[model samples]
Target chain A: MNFLSRLFGKKNIMTDITIIGTGNMARGLAARAIAGGNSVQILAHGDKAKADALAAEFTGQVSTGVLGDAVTGSIVIPAVYFDAAKEIVARYGDGLDGKVYVDITNPVDFSTFEGLSVPAGSSAAEELQKATGAKVVKAFNTTFAATLGEGQVAGQKLDVLVAGDDEAAVAAVAAFASAAGLTPIVVGPLRRARQLEQTGFLNILLSANEQLPQFQWNSALSFVPAA
Target chain B: MNFLSRLFGKKNIMTDITIIGTGNMARGLAARAIAGGNSVQILAHGDKAKADALAAEFTGQVSTGVLGDAVTGSIVIPAVYFDAAKEIVARYGDGLDGKVYVDITNPVDFSTFEGLSVPAGSSAAEELQKATGAKVVKAFNTTFAATLGEGQVAGQKLDVLVAGDDEAAVAAVAAFASAAGLTPIVVGPLRRARQLEQTGFLNILLSANEQLPQFQWNSALSFVPAA
Candidate 1:
């Protein structure tokens, strides 16, 4: 895409985004997607009440029964667990084909939060790319869920680092991020997920109270010129 | 230590630091420590000639013999290889005791720069802390070695992330970083080394040639207010 096209891609932009998962991050991103001037739908497994509640809260639609409905949108956001992603794709099937699938799950082994659940030398995003055969793009895995709820900070906005081997899919997610009032930092390729996970680890270390007595959770990475 | 002492400890400001590695990172930090007004030294083994050559080019001192002579000052910096640290520590022995030891090395298995050397639950800095009695402090492991040498970019000094259980040691390294014309960001306690290493991994991901194309090697992390 041209620089101007990429920059103003979201201008007067109205797109369809389907959020898969009923968890906090899914809810949060769904709300932001609405705020970003897009149609959003939440898909949860046998949890229509929670989905309905989020829909009511965010003024978006909710899909509790059919996975196909959730994957029908132009941008299908699988904001669910990593292990659950394969099942999600299996259920959604070819409905996800030809759509920009955004995988925002951390895929971290929550029991340890030390290593990844994916096999050594492999990435969860890459696995999802292989499983679904959909255009998979990685984004929204860096920021804290609470930060996503707040979205903008200090009158500026948070940056969403997006990575994917697919150029057109990456561009689509970048537009979605911009529509949500965020600056999308497109990292190199899908393999860059390894680094994205590492960045998340760094942020967690800096923010988590168990690590340091005086460290606050508010600090973030910003780009500036040489001092 | 009191909050103010922890914030800007005066005692460590006067501590002399001798870096024991002559790699790019070692050279970068050595330059900074010298700028910080601390007595800086470089110790290189096997390749003492290369170390000496770098020291001469940078106008610093290089040591090949005894660790005692190299670490006579208040701070001893082990900037060598991950596997080589134990040997260096064994050689240093009593010389490392009662001194603030700064660890700027990442256990990144360069063989597969895509992954870490140590297992998920451990960190190189922590391992150094355990093996050596020299109150260990983890710093300057988050950024690229090139960025470290350059010090600042786009009119802003790069921030050095430091983590360790020892407040005094961390503060000392922070002072050294500041003096070298870089910002010292004390990112919590020692366990946060995991985060810093992960940050390094993220940086690598951003720079991976096959990944996100916009992630230039020169690009780095900086922060500004929410606005």
Candidate 2:
């Protein structure tokens, strides 16, 4: 059951997702993706040991190497920094011609954490989408890495608010989210990624609040229907 | 059921809720407060005609006056711009020795809309509280005026998140919110107003998103409690 099989009218399509980093966010997402029953691979930029450790830790169908190694999957997810996203995509031997690129990094100026690193009107995901000609979709930028790793918060599984213009690609992502034990709330088109980034920034501000400075990373966005 | 009646054992302490400004927000909040059974008043800064029209439109309960009039009974809520919040409060008077001052304005630099206009590491409500010794509490900043006017969306009543150092003050504001037909969500302490302001900013960003632009001012923040 591989991606190729599913694409050819076959019942089995085990979507293989390859993450390009071994950092906290990358490892967290890789673990979740692995837990969701998808084939996961780890690409260590320099530290091969760290990547191998992550692969072993999650019991994932993971492999380790430099970015140029054949990614062997249809959906090659780069779970790294914004600057690294394009670089890693460039490292792939065959460009993402028919792949759905998902950008989750919040290109925020962490030194300030008060504002974004991008221009006044633009966002990180939009920039990355343009940088790599891959069909980029913005998702998983609002939730924290801790919550992403843990999945359940205060016992209730968290919700992932996703937005992207591609309906079919978004459907694939929503399925992936469900596999990760998250309730995926599809908000709107890709540009709404700005909302996700801004909301992520606001959540960061909330985490800095003195009164509730210690807010658990478990909190999430939910839609409560009117009674 | 009046403020004094609920307080000093009089069973007759009338809550004189006066809003300064004849803008849509002021009109909307005043209408909700009046519906909540408070003795509401409207003090027009300069547009007495609009104030009178709104007062007449809602009912005789909301009277109009100049900005400096002493708003007797209950709490005196300052519904104005963050920069103007302090100025309006000063114009109205600083002798708010024992009254609860509800600050619903989010400190947004509308000219930029990139972030807040106030000092970094703080929020509009916090700044207002520091400026006035009127036991300030933050509430209603999370919802749009239109949503507040509508009271609910998709059958779900909207939530008004309140935060303040004073528990009693927060509770009082919560009472007012409940009276207005919205759900009051007490999100920890007053210092959390910083977070509330940030949340408001993010919601504005959501509205600014092109694809789902104006996806109904009906949308609101709903909590997903841990199961």
Candidate 3:
């Protein structure tokens, strides 16, 4: 079921992005990557069928492989949960070095639904950066997977809040977002991911809130820039 | 120099809102309250002239007084910093009991510019609520004072995120926000203020960022609702 674009023994076609996991986020981000004229490689969680199914839906625009197979994209995104994201980094290890690793996970502590699961003053992106030399950039964490398909909420473009210490990495993510027809708002260093996660958490809370019927999972925390 | 609304012996006309401090926030919020058809009272910090000057700008639409004077509004907003907000609550004591006290402070730890100045689990609103019997509602903290004047960002209505344990207090703040030509997004109980504070802090960081010139102080962290 693992359909290799090039022969396993031959040089594979490099992709603009490698998305780990075959979930909604994976599908959503892959859509954006394709729309942005960027090729994608899907590294599914051992479910070759699921990966193949999604790849077929994308009209064979993406290369499909299992998680352990070599990641063939310059930009790697684990469209998985925070814990799983950490595991992916550990699995890839030094292989991710010099690659743009985008951390879109919001580590929410659902135990109390009180705060984030990450430790104080640090963010998921920063922690993921610690696991490898990957240029970790925090983007799309503030954006819901549902909204990424349309690339907007309401009539406004989705504000992709990017945070990373690596300038090249941040710019790379921003370029992709802009190419996808989304507005990328660079929110300073990786530490700012702490705030971005909170912003995302607040959005989730509002969406899940029965009291706030207006705010849904598809809502966008759009930063309306001054004219 | 305390320009009492009425003499110490006479009955004063109660206002719909009382705002402490004559800073930018005070002026901005006063604009909203008046636009909403709500009368305001300004309680300045021993600066009767400053209070009088602002009250004059409102063209006698608001009453003026120095701090320690009796609060006359059903809803009182301390349009001051986090530290000064606590001081105002302490100065008022049980007099604020049964009133709607709105906490609009972010409490950022400027020394590190890292996380919030508040403790790990608590927020400015929750802390302020504990200090007084006043029903503390968190609103306008996520909004910059500059936007209140025009009441919109990029032609969209300003989103007022309100949070509080007291449904009545929360409702009251929402009502005010709605009347002021803004969208009042109730983001759950006062506990959610923790995230709201983080949201506000993030907005501040984005604004102060010299690199992201688009995200200025006049910009907005708008939660664009799903259609």
Candidate 4:
């Protein structure tokens, strides 16, 4: 079936997953969603021209628009940095209520990578959820945009850590990852976003280290539980 | 040569690695040291009897003493929790000067697992270093005691992340890990211990989740950088 048909496929697949922002992460998530056989709607935070340019690069059922333009997807993934994601959430207001929002922000202080930008004992996902009162699931924050686009790291399948209070929303995000052929580990409740963010920030710190050339921006965190 | 000979081998191996506290972590680290062909000196926080019992369980040159005893090893690894490590550091005072102190405490708020016991912008290792001008190397905090004792995780060589500001101290810890057949990734300076502690705490949270039975106390964090 075509991307359009698969998006609303025989199983009554949900609406197009709306993506806000036109950047590396946005492009990467869009590619993953399409790879999972779901249509994608890309909404640029600003400058529709960039969104249009990014969408044009992809094949199948994909659409693009400016941020304030209506969000068409049942699941919304703001694949931007922490501050931009917050701004998008603020602009959307109650519009994002009930929407399956996915937060993939590290919120680390880029200048020093010493600490997270979000308040202590809290995470970007938690703060954004509190701001919009949306069903926010923290996923893909640990995966590099390049790895997400490539769908693997060092010849191994990538594991996406998912955390959210809403069960169905968590399952939905898990399913999205599964459909894309990535293993989804449901870490725990939304509070786990704090750990997930820290983990991501840790990877960021390692990536920034010039001494360790192997741990480039693409280092992936893998945890293997006992069989 | 025997463990004692290896401790001061013909190459001038070095002093026995001193491990403080008689907990599972102490046993794990001591076992690792013996596995690396080095003698071990364990100092119990309060009960020398407990330290004696634990030392008696080992197969090689191992000694036991109370907390106030002179630390024999140039490298000291406190396997106690965060607070006890601090108390031990305080008691040791300038004695720990120039020592390669290994901090394994996660500093997690076990009461809720919602936050860390260490203050913002600091880690358990960083705090302990400030307490005693000891050259602290943050290592083994990411590995479970059981897995460390076993020397491998799920049939794979465990990747021990080593972070510290001291070059020789970091190399000492890395050599210790390497002698035990584990891969040591020198992440960065000691400040990066903040991330290492968070990584360990995240593992704890996952281990506590009933839904994830596989991620029991034995769950291991393994990261493979690009070749």
Candidate 5:
């Protein structure tokens, strides 16, 4: 059966995911969405061709459109950089109300990688939540794009550390993650995004260190329970 | 054999560890030091009785002294709070030069538990390194006091993430951690301490979270490698 046929043939669709941007994260998340049996909508910021190319790569129930178009999915993932994610959130405004906005951007000051770009005590996810009425959930920030494509690091399942204030919003994201064959560890409320962002920054630092070859970008930040 | 006899009777002492502070972390680290067969010295800021009491618990080659007194061990662990640690370092001055200083304080702002108390581009360990000429190493910040006492979380060995600019200093700290029955994952240079401190803050936030019962004070910030 074709990807579209499989998507539409389902009696009850779990959730439709709208991914913004045409970058690696956008592609990675889109792949996971398709694998999880969810319809995906790819939105390009300015270049429609880029979105079209990304959409063409997948045969599932996927569509492409410009950024300003109406979002058609219950879960909107702004898989863009931190600044672009902010702009998308602001532009969506009240249209995103009640929507689960999945924020995967790590607001790291890449110039130094010594600290994050967000203000003290705040995170990109929390700031995005403030800019819009959408229930912003922090997920996939720690999962490198390359690793996300494989859907697992090493042999263990990818652990998606999720944090958000709204229980239903967090649950919605968690449901999608579980369906994608990832372990969803719901850390705490939305405020926990602060640490989640820091953890992402720490992981990035480890990946960039030339001395620690084993901690390349592909390593997973896992919570191994005692045997 | 008694703790002291075992500590000094050996041809070579594994490591002489001097821990400052009478708090839970002090006791926890002292317990690990004794368990690792290292001679320990307990230093109290104002209360000699507290240090004496902690020393009395360990029948090893343990001693007690005030903060300004000469540090007796080759490796000194500042197990006090962040501010107190800074003060202790300043008071010790050049006396700490050439010594291996282990910084276990997580410079967190408990007011919000949202960010660190240190500056944007720095950490408690880095700041301590700058204050004194001692080779400062970041360790045990991610390990909770309770977990340090047990040396493991959920049966898995505690992963002690170490960061220091000096290679030998980092190795010394790593050796102590290994002898104490913990896995020492040396992350990178001293700058990596920034991320380490942030990770500590993040872990603290999770522990303080009321909703996440599983992430109590005893939980660990672990990096589970692929099986």
Candidate 6:
């Protein structure tokens, strides 16, 4: 056992999370990961300066690298758009084997925001899973970037709707969510990602809607338990 | 405008709603409409006895009739499945020109439960709107029949998400929802029904999942305001 583990009596282990992309989602996730006491790595696509800037905001063991470099974490989160997320997985290839891949892409067709870009009966997470052998978990797609930045909407903690075919992988993600001060609701298998993506699209549509003034980008999707 | 209106004043004006089908959803909606002080008519397709039985359960101004009979209400709610809802709309034709149509169909392929049965970029509400020139509003699809029976789940009022292209039609449905003691969240136009149906399908998928013990059929989807 390591000295830290022996001294603490409990396993003093820190989860290592690699976040791909340096966008708003990437920064939100990195903030949560750092707050959860996990080590985070920022990977920038073509722009190393962006990753470095994001990493500089954190004090913990945060690292920066360019895409295609060797991923150093067991749980890799792709916070990029749908197409980029797929490309990242394809480019990583066998490197993601056995690793828990967190997919936060909404897969919405921005051109119209009317429908999903994914093919019928498939989701971005499922597509990522098909591209690589990683344990892909669909999460954070339903949450807005602004909500994730604050980790809560209004006074309620954000509900992270997670879906994955692998139970252990889902539990790992759930643990990460709980540690990050978010509520994790594991809806179902990876196939449920299709629904999650749809709901996420709906949430985004509501946020963009001018009619619903109260539903800003800071709004969230939550499943309230019956009283 | 009429003798009834003169007798009861503005407060005495109760909306007359014609609900097609005598199924669980039909009964549940009828119960709510009655409790909300609205006159409800039950329309049965090829089965008058079922509609009669449902109408008999309510002491309020509830009536029963055949499907093709003249719908005697400003708001006509099709509580049947997607296919049947379409058929009803097609049969009604121009008779539904100015009336408000409430579409409660989910249009989910229950056999697979993987996706919606509606065509790409279309929804059951949208298809129904195309069939007739009636003002179509999408609501009550997300609320389960049992939950609708009580009009609230776990002490929290059920959120009836209303989506329609007609502002007046949406307002009428919203008024009905408020009278029924439920919160009405008008998402957007009829096109937004696409997302509502997707979220309904997702809710069903979660309810059917044996792995998610907490996601019982009684669970309600709510957008809790941040404190």
Q: Model 1, DockQ value?
A: 0.36
State the C-alpha lDDT per candidate.
0.69, 0.69, 0.87, 0.84, 0.83, 0.85
Scored against the true structure, residue B119 in model 5 reaches a CA lDDT of 83
1 versus 2: better TM-score goes to: 1
C-alpha positional error of residue B46 in candidate 3 after TM-score superposition, expressed in Å: 0.9
- The numbered model that scores best in lDDT is 3
In candidate 3, how many clashes are counted? 0
Q: Given the true complex, what DockQ would model 5 score?
A: 0.43
Alpha-carbon lDDT of model 6: 0.85
Error of 1 at B147 (Å): 4.5
Q: What TM-score, computed on C-alpha atoms, does each candidate reach?
A: 0.72, 0.64, 0.95, 0.90, 0.82, 0.87
lDDT of 2 by residue, B1-227 (tens): 23443466422334468677777678668867887877776767776687677778775355566566565546777667877788976655666766788888878788966567867556787777776768888888877777777777666677787887887888888888899898787776676676577667666555665555434454676543334
Task: Write one digit per residue (lDDT tens) for candidate 6, span A82-107.
Answer: 89988898898998899999999988
Docking class of 4: medium
lDDT of 6 by residue, B1-227 (tens): 24664586423354489899998999889989988898877889888899889988888877677899788778999899999988887888898899999999899887877788988878888988888889999999899888888888777788888999999999999999999999898988899898899899988877887877777787788765445
| Cα lDDT of model 3 by residue, A1-227, tens digit | 12444455212667789999899999889889988988788888988888888877774357788988888889999999999988988988888889999999989887887788888778888888889889999999888888998888877788899999999999999999999999998888888888888888888888888988787788898878877
Candidate 5 wrongly placed segments (more than 4 Å): A1-15, A44-60, A65-68, A90-97, A154-157, A187-191, A224-227, B1-15, B34-37, B45-61
Best by TM-score: 3
TM-score of chain B of each: 0.81, 0.87, 0.94, 0.92, 0.92, 0.91
Residue pairs with backbone overlap in model 6: A154-B226, A154-B227, A155-B226, A155-B227, A227-B154
The stretch of ten residues in a row with the least summed lDDT in candidate 2 chain A is A6-15
Candidates 4 and 5: which is better by DockQ? 4
The DockQ score of candidate 6 comes to 0.55
Report the C-alpha lDDT of model 1 over A114-154, residue by residue, as the tens digit: 55677655678888888887899989887666567777555
Candidate 5 - CAPRI tier?
Answer: acceptable
